[model samples]
Target: MIQNIVLGQIKRDPRSVAMANAYGTIADGYFAVGYNPAMLAYQQDKPFMLQLFGIDMGIGGNFISLQNLNSLSGDTIYAAGENPKNPHDDSKDRLFRQFDDAGGLAFRQDFHLPMPIINYSSGNMAFTSNLVWMSNLVFPIGILELLFYGNGRRPNMDMTFNVEVFGVNELGFTFAVPYDRFALGATVKYLQGLFYFGVDPDSSRANLVTSDYHLYGSGKYLFRFG
Candidate 1:
């Protein structure tokens, strides 16, 4: 439904909107994978590179990248804007907490999901983030369930439980090259994220001090390619 609504808006001017969306898709590095996964396939003999970028749109954007760290490792660090709350308070602990908390996991209490794997490969895996359980399954099937409708707490769990993520979570491969432009190489890609913080608790759109208190999610999806 969200995609349908978004697509509908773009359909009004498919040409320009499509191009804009295409540019963004490319900017995200998906084009690199689509254009030539082969080029990214080679790694062992390429010079490692690190890229750092930033942006300012009344707010701000900052990012860093490490490419081809040896034959099997890489990393990236990124942060867009300083949270309005306690923006000037540069304490190490809060910064560290913000860096690790992600995927809204820090907003609510008493949320749990058994990380179950549904698919696996040397460099890729697919998993279910959500699950459904009924009390009858654990209790009784024939008991006179008088207290049936709304008899128990309907807990609202994290989105990961209901949302399905089919992604290239990890990728790696080896390629053969010749002398000069020929060599052998390999690569590895890994993915992880955490998001916290609830939606704006009140009309106050930005995080601030003394007015209210809330948790926010901070997460980044790192990409690695040689």
Candidate 2:
């Protein structure tokens, strides 16, 4: 079976969209609670700033060219699915040629809640508390090839699907301190997995909850002597 999908542009607020440039707060205003915590100390005396209900969604992939698929006419290579069991000829070759790339499809969306919950700043230290809902989906060609016999390696043309949907609810705290031309930042997060649905070729899974709870943290030091 061959599948063709076309993705669309996502819409998000400025704050959420700016998260992509979270490299090190090189742009205007101090952003990115984790990436550049130290920059928080350099901000104006706002004492508190809130981020409410911002969302981010991104799609990137070029597995197959839609133009190529649409250009074909009746009885073309992508016309219909045929039984590979009775095939031993050039028709098999045509099936492989239909898909342009068959690489993979990736999608992710982050929902920032209306909880600055702790967007407070004091002296040279900044603290932030927030929650984010994240989800990701990826369908790789290699795995699809296994399930669909797209590579024709499976003995039988039997088709199976591997659908995995992952979701995470994360609560995080960020702290930052700046000194002269040096800056330091740290972030701690508590993660709760919402769902995990997929077929594990190596193991077995009946439900979609992989991890109940998890903890993650990171620290960064920036020596900006310039």
Candidate 3:
């Protein structure tokens, strides 16, 4: 089963979740902080933009299911399908069979913490301070099988697991310059390296104990451009 911790929960912003930040109505106010800073240059003459604490989550995949769990929890579980008996014939069917119905997991999360210390607009000139963060995780079908059903029903061949997880935080200011029917915008940013962890282990015929996670590196810096 998939488990996670959920921060402050509240009514979600319909607009932010309804569509991607790239395409949507400006009337909705403050566009995506990462994409098209220039779009904010055309705000509807609002006095202030307040983007306090908010969280967004996206989960998708087709690996873990009632069938998979049932098989794993049975008194005397057996491989779903009999292992290819005898010398397998070499063909497209033989090679692709490994991933037929293995299973998978994917997820994305956004944690907002009173970002944009300051964000206000008037006329053509727009000024703002923005802070944003995001995290992504995915697990292929082969990895799931080795982790969940490797003991009960051992399969043929070996597999490697290289799962990755990291987060990025950007602190910066955005300004826009308008010209007749056109306008330009730029953002100066200070990037902070929060953390990064990795694990590289060959299943070695479905050994449960893998490898230890090692500390890598983390830092911060400043950069800006259009």
For every model shown, the clashing-pair count is: 17, 1, 2
lDDT of each residue in 77-127, candidate 1, tens digit only: 222333355455444334333323432212111222223342111111111
Error of 1 at 11 (Å): 27
Which residue pairs clash in candidate 3?
Answer: 63-103, 63-104
Model 3 residue 154 lDDT score: 37
Give the Cα lDDT of each candidate: 0.24, 0.42, 0.43
Ranking by TM-score: 3, 2, 1
Number of the top TM-score candidate = 3
| Residues 1-226 of candidate 2: C-alpha lDDT, one tens digit per residue | 1010221111233654457543455422224454455666676674555443344443333333466455543532321345454443444344444331432444444454434435444444444433444444444333444443443353222122234445555555555677878877665656666665555534421211112253222322222111
Candidates 1 and 2: which is better by TM-score? 2
User: Regarding lDDT, does 2 or 3 come out ahead?
Assistant: 3
Model 3 TM-score is 0.49
